[model samples]
Target: MTSTDATTSMFERIGGSDTIDLLVDRFYDRMDTLPEAKTIRAMHADDLGLIRDVLKRYLTEWTGGPKLYTPEKGHPRLRQRHFGFAIGDAERDAWMTCMRGAMEETVTNAAARQDLDKALSGLADWMRNRQ
Candidate 1:
């Protein structure tokens, strides 16, 4: 008989910021080398340090942690921020591929992983700026 409290939330169970940081790091690392990610990769500067940090912070707030990103960056107009880039199906798919790989490597809970993946799939499609 396991108490429900014995189970941690995905956000807490994954070791919080540390796990998110590792995932973001691995995600950017994959982006650096994946041929499919070349176009999206080119959109970013060579240095991925800041990008990784921002993503980690963003995820922290997004996944029921402290409100890190909102206080620092204000509203996260995700679509507006990404509007500068031509995000077609290819770019969206590439980004999702990297994220999926990273998620698989970092996240442990089956339900949590599925929830995040489904949400991400919708968000990635919504971010598409091009046909």
Candidate 2:
């Protein structure tokens, strides 16, 4: 049977810093090149390195790993932080396309990928500010 210990964080289940790094890297790489991600990609800076590091840190703390992000950033303020960008259904869908591809390529466990996808969908939807 699969280990379902309550104490186990998704961070641990998904591997660790290395896996998070790989996932973030793959995510941005997809966003950088995928034709489907073109619109969403335009929203980001040409240099993805900074966003990549922030995401890695955010995901680390978000998934119950060490508190790396909050200590530095105070709070994620996800929606407010994204307010500058006009996120709509198309943008959210495009973002999800890259994320889904990244998760599929990086996450080996089916159950874990499903869980991440569900949560990511909600978060991405919430980021949308436009109709």
Candidate maximizing lDDT:
2
Could you say which candidate leads in TM-score? 2
Instruction: Supply every candidate's count of residue pairs whose N, Cα or C atoms clash at under 3 angstroms.
Output: 0, 0
Candidate 2 whole-model C-alpha lDDT, 0 to 1? 0.89
User: Per-residue lDDT tens digits of candidate 1, residues 1-131?
Assistant: 01452455546755588878888988898899899889889999889889888998888887767788999899999999988999999999999999999889988865667777887799899999889
TM-score of 1: 0.88
The pairs that clash in candidate 2 are none
| Alpha carbon lDDT of each predicted model | 0.83, 0.89
TM-score of each predicted structure versus truth: 0.88, 0.93
lDDT of 1 at 109: 68
Q: Tell me the deviation in Å of residue 42 in model 1.
A: 0.7
Q: What is the lDDT of residue 112 in candidate 1?
A: 69
Which portions of model 1 show Cα errors greater than 4 Å?
A: 1-10
Residue 74 deviation, candidate 1, in Å? 0.2
